[model samples]
Target: MKAAIATSYGSPDVIHLAEVPMPTPKPTEILVRIHASAVNAADWRLRSANPWFVRLVFGPFKPRRPILGVVFAGEVVGTGVAATKYKKGDKLFGWTSLMKLGGHAEYVALPETGAFAPIPAAMSYTDAAAIPFGFGTAFSFLRKAQVAQGQRVLIYGASGAVGSAAVQLAKTMGAQVTGVCSTRNTELVRSLGADHVLDYTKDDILAKRDLYDVVFETVGKLPFKESLALVKQSGTIITGSEMPTQMLARLFAGKADKQVKVIGGTALSTAADMKHLAQLSAEQAILPVIDQVLPLERIVEAHARAESGRKVGNVVVEMG
Candidate 1:
């Protein structure tokens, strides 16, 4: 099996393609022949081991997992005796947990009970593989915010992977969605169901007088404090990165009035959430906005593109 492995954390050049042993499934796992995978910001973040603090998990000097990919869309080629939910040739899409990152290979073995879900008839492998990180993150945050119909929701970086998904999900939940992006993506965000589009590059989102019931900062730019004024009383702010000190202060201050809440972290995805997303796709209620698709051999280049943090949506890596 050929895989792109990282022996140490640095530039995308550190990742190189090489022949590696194919993985086998354990009694509770399944061996998937990967067809496609998507690169999340987490992939590059882990590769470079940025922020210094994350080195505790990735490594102080190098990555713990040599092959770095989390989301995958593949077919079950073999399954362990204990795996009953799927059999040979079952097409699925999902992600492994934090400790089991090996989706960059031609094949990977993961627990059958992980976030895996059957790919919808309407979804292609490329699109299915793109779901876990972006869609899963959006679902988790919206669920946390308890989004409801008619609520005013603001989404920063509405053209990025998670931001794009958040716009669609917020619309599905009947929120009046305001998406912040660049002028180039205003139409794209509108097509994704954002009720309003603001170009953060030209306009001042903080200057907007309308307050939001929920503020979702998907790009990790604009500190929590800067967005505080936009949140309505008793409203909440959700970010896709770790909660910093300023966010903590708002979290505590809001407790007395419960007017504001700051939340952040990777989402805990479930098969049920993936299934729901599949249904939405089949119904054409939600469309996966893929920015580009690259062959697995070009993974290093894909990492570079993802690192720019300017992509309009998910960038997929086709494996098979």
Candidate 2:
């Protein structure tokens, strides 16, 4: 099996294409022959361990997991003795669990009961691969925030993967969507169903007070205090990126917040979320915006693009 392996975490240059041993499924697992995978913020974040805290999971000296990918769309090539959920030739897509991340390869083995889901026949492998991260994250956050119809929802960094997904999903949920992105992506964000588009370069959206019922920072770049201010009284602010103070506050704040709640949270990559995304994709209700498709060999370039914070949507890597 050919895989992009990371021996030591650093720059994109650290990832090397190598011939690795083929993975065999455990008795409760299914072996998937990967057709395509997608590069996301998680991939690069794990690659470089940007925040020093990442070293705790990836390893201080070296990575615990060599292969680096979270989202994958593939076909089941074989199944283990006890794995009954899927059989040979079943097409599927899912994100590898936090501890079992190994999607950037020709093949991977995951438990039958894991996050994997059958890809809709109408969807391409590349599209299926693209949905798990951005779409899944957006779906989780929006649903958790209880986004409702007619409510004003603002999404910061609205042109990237998660942001783009957030835009369409928020609109589908009946919220009046406002998307914030660069000047170049105003039309792209608007096409995703944003009722209003704010170019961060020209518009100081933070100046607006109490504008949104739900304010979502998809890229995790907004200041926590500012995000809180953007939300209406007793409303919600959901952010993918967060600082320790924000995380600690949310942790102690318990399950519900009576006042304006700031959520620096994670999107659940459960099988249910994948199924929901599949149905949405099948109906063309929510589309996974694909920025580019590169071969596994060009993974370095792919990583560079994802790290550059300039791509309009998902960047897919097709298996050769």
Candidate 3:
């Protein structure tokens, strides 16, 4: 088996491919031969340990897991005796959790029941692999917001992975969706069901006061004050990106504005959420917006592309 591994975090150049031992499943696990996987901002973030705090969770000197990938679309090649949920040749897609990430490899072993579902018949392996992080995160935030019909929802960075998915999900919930992106992506965002498109370069989103019932800051840079001003009274702001200062502020702001709530963190993904995303894909309601596809050998390039922050949606890496 060939895998891209990182010993110490720094730049994308630190990741290199080498032959590694094939993984075998434990009694409660299944061995999946990966077909396609995705490179996300999280992948690069963890790889480089961008924020100094990540060093505490992963490692101070090196990464806890050498191979870094979160989403995988693959076929079950072998299963342990205790694994009853799936058998050989079952095609599935899902995300590997923080501690168990090894999706960058040609094969990975996951518990019989982790975050995965049968790929939708209408979707390809590349597309299914793209779902977990983007759609899962977006779905989680929207659910947290308790989005409802007729609610005006504003999505920042509406052309990226999570942002694109949020645009579609918000529309599915019958919200009047407004997407913020670069001028180049205005039409693309509109096609994803955003009722309005704001080019960040041209429009000043903060200037639009009290306009939305829910403001989703998918890009993570939206300031707390601007977000507070953008939302209607009692509205909620959900951020999926890392903003430690804002997170800490929200934690001790009981005496602060009680009318607005700011939330941030990675979503808790479940097999059920993957299944629901599959159903939406089967129905053509939400589609994976793939920016580029590369072979596993090109992982360094893939990581560079994802880190560039210009990809329309996801950058996929095919394994086999």
Which has the greatest TM-score? 3
**Model 2 lDDT per residue over 1-320, tens place:** 99998899899999999999999999999999999999888889889987777899789988999899998999999999999998899999989776778899999999998886899999999989999988888888898889998999999999999999999999889999999999999999999899999988998887876789999988767766677667788898887767566666555643343377665555677898898888888889898899999999999999999999899899999998
Q: By summed lDDT, which 10 consecutive residues of candidate 2 come out lowest?
A: 249-258
Clash pairs for candidate 1: 234-259
- The candidate, 2 or 3, that scores higher on TM-score is 3
Give the poorly placed runs of model 2, Cα more than 4 Å off: 245-258
C-alpha lDDT score of every prediction, in listed order: 0.86, 0.88, 0.89
What is the lDDT for 273 in model 2?
Answer: 84
- Over the stretch 118-233, how does candidate 1's per-residue lDDT look in tens digits? 89886889989888788888998999999999999999889999999999999999999999999999999999989999998899888864389998989878666666777887
Model 2 / residue 104 / CA error / Å: 0.5
